[model samples]
Structures are given as structure tokens and as C-alpha cells.
Target chain A: MKTTTVFTIGRQFGSGGRSVGRRLAEKLEIPFYDRELIALAAKESGLSETLFENADEKATSSLFYSMVMGTYPLGGGAIAGRSEMPLNDQLFLIQSKTIHALAEKGSCVIVGRCADYVLRDLPNVLNIFIHARMPERIKRAIENYGEDEKKAESVCIKKDKQRANFYNYYSDRKWDQSETYDLTLDSGVLGLEGSVDLIIAYDEMFRKTEGKKRMVST
Target chain B: MKTTTVFTIGRQFGSGGRSVGRRLAEKLEIPFYDRELIALAAKESGLSETLFENADEKATSSLFYSMVMGTYPLGGGAIAGRSEMPLNDQLFLIQSKTIHALAEKGSCVIVGRCADYVLRDLPNVLNIFIHARMPERIKRAIENYGEDEKKAESVCIKKDKQRANFYNYYSDRKWDQSETYDLTLDSGVLGLEGSVDLIIAYDEMFRKTEGKKRMVST
Candidate 1:
């Protein structure tokens, strides 16, 4: 079987990004994994599903610093106590393994869960972040949840903030920040299907170019 | 006549970025401006068109920072023995006027001249940056110019560095940096036509959403 490229999507809640990812995977004939990754990680790590799920895409306290010699200054030792949490390390390990497994299985679309950072240095991975205007996302949430505008608005804000917090904690970069991803799409404006089509075309082109590079080197 | 949104494209020479900008304008049925901008700036500034044309999107010391200091760093007192050139400052002023005038006239596409930074705070401006991989850009240049691969590659590298240097000098920001533009497209991967289509769609969506924002606010 030919080695396939893996696409990992990080999205804001209510942005229809998930649906876009799903459609993209279906169109490309690849597997789409979202929360399903938790189960896979659980099986691989021999930990309860919720252990991975509960920590799902949450940020851990990985302090930002550069070490001179061995000692860290500026209250670093004290903070290391809080940062050295066992649960966070275990969760990160699971997330990392799950991402690796998904890629190993061939082409797959993995949504959120620090998938981008987890597989950053991998040879054939495409990382994308999706976002949209506040109002559009709020409207989508209201429609999807069949709830009133205010409740849906709160849900949108809360969920996006959670994603941002998680991304900031684990990645050396910020979440939903366009610079972090190879491709960043305003899914709300691109319309779900159009974005999916664009990404598929982009990924195909990228892989073809990569193949040419390998052939030239050989 | 209705006002249409203006798009400013910044690109590197030999990147086929200029062709992409032209195709985009044609596809959108909007006027495309590149060298044409030089004529307009000359007319606006009451300077000889040749002077402005020769300067031609070249970098000058950043006015943004100098303005904060309440004086032009280069223009201010330096030495009595050495005479300084005011040519760039004049060109910059002229180009800025031309940009505003063009925006006022109707929707149009302006290529380079740091149009993104020129129209940075404008209400309905779309800024795009076009780039390509080194090998791809060199290939395009070779095909177009009938140059050897090595020569074409050197030309591509030299031209892009000049553009980057110019942009960074004037904007105090890195050139070809993805975060600076509303959209960044790889011309090599997307191809000129695909990029044009994608951008047209993006521009349309942006306008529709901006229209909706107005409707909601009013």
C-alpha cells in the first residue's frame, strides 16, 4: 500500500469545521477521527478511556523557559512542582501515540486534540486550523443545538476558549493563530464544502510536489 | 455605480505571482494595477513620471516609525557636507495618494508597492501575498525567460530577497510573512488559475459578510 498523508484539523466550536473535515475525509476516501481517537489511545496506553478523554486536548503546565546550565531561575523550581503532574504526562503520551497510530494506518483526518503539535515533525502530515467570525459561529451553534441565541453564544465562546487554552499549554504556539498552521481557513466564510474541496486539492498538489522532491534526491 | 472592494497583492518577481494577480483581476472583472500605479503616482505628486517609475516600488526608510518620532530620520539634519536624497519620500507620498484615489474611484486590484501596508487600516481592503517554492519559481522563470536552471534559480533568489528587504525596511515587519496578509497562497502548488478562482471566491465571501455586518449594525 502506498504511504498516505495525514491531515489534522484544529477547529473552534460551532465553526462547522468538524463537518468540513468529515466531508474532506469522505471525499478523499480517508478515515476521519475525532473523539474516536480517545478510544484508540486508551487501547494503546492500557488506560481507561476517560483518563485520556477527560484530559482530552486540555492544556498542561509546561513552563516556558530557556535553561542556562541546569538550574532554572525566576521561581522555576517552585513552579516545576505544579508542572510535573503525572496525569498531564500520561495524557500527552496517549495523545502522541494516538496521532502516530492514525498516521501509521495511512491517510486519516484527525480533528483537534493537539494533533498538529503531536505530529509536527512527521514526514507526511498536513496541519490546518479553522476559524470564523464570532457572529457566524454563534449562529451555527444556535442552529445546531436548537437552543436560544444567548445560550448558544456562550457555548461558542466557552468552547473556543477551552480549545485556545489547551493549544497554548501543549504547543509552543498559540491556538487558532494562523501562523501555527500550514493552512488556516475561515470555514464560516468559505462555506463547509468549498473549504473541504480546496484542502483536498491543496493536499494533492503538496504530496505530488513532495514525491518529485524525493525522486530528484534519489 | 456600486463600490467594490479593492484587493492589493504583494508578490516576488519570478514567482508567477504577478501573473496570478493579473489573472485574478481579469477573473473578477476588475482593473489590474502594477506599473500603471507609477504613472498615477507621478500624476498625483506633480513629479516627473520617470522618477517615480524608476523608483518603482523600491523600499524607503519606514515612515511609520519616523512619524512617531515627529521627524523623518533620513530627511532630518545629518551633515552639511552630504546631501541626502528625498526621492523615496516623494515616491512614497505619491504612491499613497494614488492608492487612496484608486480606492475612491472603484474596486480595483493593485499588485505590490506594499499595498497591504499602504491600505492597512482601510475599511474594505483585501490583501494577499503570493509565494512559491524555490524550485517551482525557478522552473517558471526558466520556462518564461529561456534561461539555464542555475541562472533562473539565482534570478529567483535575488529578486525575492530584494522584495523581502524592501518590504521589511518600509513596514518594520518581515516580508512574505503569512500573518501580514488576509490570505497567502502558494502559486506553484495552486497554479495561477486555481489561485485566481480561490481568491475571487474569497473576495466575494468577504464582501457578503461585510455587507451583513453593516446590516446588523445599522
Candidate 2:
């Protein structure tokens, strides 16, 4: 039987990471999850999709409170004291649970929602971080997202900070920290297509090593 | 005329980054500078080579003082107040100058000595950071470097921290920070050969983009 490999991507805003992940999933013939994750989490947790969307990759004021009380959730489960958790924390737990379920179901590509941290224990998972230089990112924002040329730089910076805050608050690891990921690619240098190709190459090499390790263990 | 593209590698101890740089230089038919950079710097600055060897990638006590005074060097030249600088700072300036001179000469693979930071202004430079899992690094330290099994982990950690301190002190950027680099690869995942391949691939794509920009500008 063939083993499955799940890919989790954390990306900077306007870095083309989402496009890369989506294209990679298509190339690999796997399911891709991004904003689709919010709907899944909502359905699984019996929560409103809008709630997840609103709080998506945005840290809440109760972050400090949750951190102080150590109320973050890990793994898929119904927590004993989950009722007292903030809505943001509750949503995060639900999303994490959804990510866990998705990974268990089959090979897939998951973007953001701290999927890398969620699937940290799985040996079959590869975590990637995608970033680009500020100028290129700003240009991408302006071109792809139709962001205003004058405000695009600040918009990109703000979105990255929001993602970082959300990831840092929810996970034990910091966002965009190189050590936390198996590979970090500069989309500005590689371009979206090149990034996808490199990722596929890396994944192929990665699976071969994993196969050897599994054979040795078994 | 063909353009020169310098590659600067920053690495954790036991990551086989030195070997990777040397091998990459050989594959590309270019000069590889590691400890040889020390000799070049010594000759250029008329400083003792031992002084550079002693201060190599080891932050000095005056790091904070130099930071506060804004005495760090960036380009290839003698500073106005160079004589008054600490020995470590003087060595760093000399080394930075040597790096600048080497890069100016032709394409080369330079390992450590803050080559990435020194050559930051150059459009033809690719900055890479290589790291590996601690266990793998520890194992490599023991098997390859003849480090004692028990002390390998701490030795790796110490060397990495020393390099980080030196990089952080001399450059505007923090060591191992993902955004500071064009690419960061996990040797634990890709291994040395895979890393070298990925870098060459990225470099080819990067140069194509650079070539386009140059054509547009000219």
C-alpha cells in the first residue's frame, strides 16, 4: 500500500503561496483546502461559517487571556473546559480539528489556519512557508488582488502581521520562523509556477526518504 | 557579456553547508570561499590572520557598544574612525571588505562570514540558509566531525548560537530570520545533494528574472 503525504503551507500576503498550493494540489491530484476549510470547520463544529471567516487569521483581544490561562487546544477532541474559551479560541480549536480530520482522510494540501502546527506530529506531513520581497509582494497585490497602488505596501504588511499574530498566538511556534518549516521558498525569486515545480521536486525527494525510513522501521 | 551571480550560504553547524557550498562551487565552476576568506581579509587589511580566526563568527563583548555607536561597516572601504573600533569590529570590516572584493571579481560561493549581509546590495547575489533537525545535526556532528556522542548536541547549539550572534551583531538583519534570506532549506529533509539542486534551480529562475529586468532598464 502506498502512504499518503499531506502538505501544509503558511504564506505571506500577496506571495502567491495560495496559488502555488492550489496548483500543486491539482498537479498532484489531491484535494486542496484554503477558505474551504472554514466551511468544513463550521459544518463539523455546528458553528456559523461567517464566524470563522470573520476571525480568520486575525488574533482576538482575548489572546493574552487565553495564553495566560493556557487554553489553546491540540489534536482533535471535545475539551473538558471548552465552554469557557473565547469564541476565537473555540473557532481555532474547531479549525484545528477539521485540519486533523482532513489529514487523516487522505493526502491533501492545507493552507493557513495553522495547519502545519495542527499536523505537527504526523511524519507524513511536509510544512512549507512562502514569502516574497516587499516590492514584489506589493506589485502582486496591486496586480492580482486589484489593491490600490499607493496603499498596497501597507496592506500587504498589515495582512502579514495579522497572519503572524494569529499563528503566533495559536501555535507553540512563531509564524514565518524558518526552523518551524521543512522548506521556505521565495515566490518573488521562483515565480508561482517555479515555486510549484520546486515544491513537487522536494516532495518527491521527501517521500523517497520517508519510504526508506518506513522500510527500516517495519 | 555573461553576468556573475554570487551565492552566499548561512548555515547551522553540522548542516554540511560548507560541503554544500564547496560542492556547488565545483559544480558551477566557480571559486568557493570559506576559511580562505580569512586569509584574503588578513592580506587586504594588513591584520594578523589569527585575529580573524579568533573573532570568526563569534560575537565580541563590544557588540552592544558597537550597535549603540552605529559603527558597523557595510561596504568595501576603510571607515573614518576605523582605528578606534574594537578589534572584533575591525576584523568584521576587513572581512566585509574582502567579501565585497571577492564578489566584485566574479561569481563565487561564499560560506558564512556574513557574506549575505555584506553583499545585500548586489542584485546578482542569492542568499541561502541551510539548517537541519537537531537530532540529525547531532548525528552528523558525531559521525562526520568526530564529535563525542554525548557532547555533540550542545556543541552544535553553541556553534549555531555563536554564528547567530556574530551575524546579528554585524548585520542589520537577525540571523536565521526567514525574510532575510532568499531561500531556507532543511538539509534534514532535502539532504545536501537535494539542497544543491534546489539552489541551482532557484538561481537559474532568479537570473532569468534579473535578465529580464536588466533588458527592460537598458
- Scored by TM-score, the top model is 2
Please provide, for model 2 over A63-140, each residue's C-alpha lDDT reduced to its tens digit, 9 standing for 90 to 100. 645753474442333445665666678788878988999999989999998998888777788889998877778888
Maximum-DockQ candidate:
2
Candidate 1 stretches with Cα past 4 Å from truth are A1-3, A62-85, A145-148, A151-158, A211-218, B1-6, B10-39, B45-97, B100-108, B111-182, B186-218
Give per-residue lDDT, candidate 1, residue A142. Answer: 80
Model 2 residue A15 CA deviation in Å: 1.8
Off by over 4 Å in 2: A1-3, A63-81, A146-150, A211-218, B1-3, B63-81, B146-150, B211-218
Write one digit per residue (lDDT tens) for candidate 2, span B1-218.
23778999999998888888988999899999999999988887766688679788877775644753574443433444664666677778878888998999989999999898888777788888987777778888999999999999999999988998889988877788787787888776666887787787777767766432211110
True contacts kept of 2: 0.40
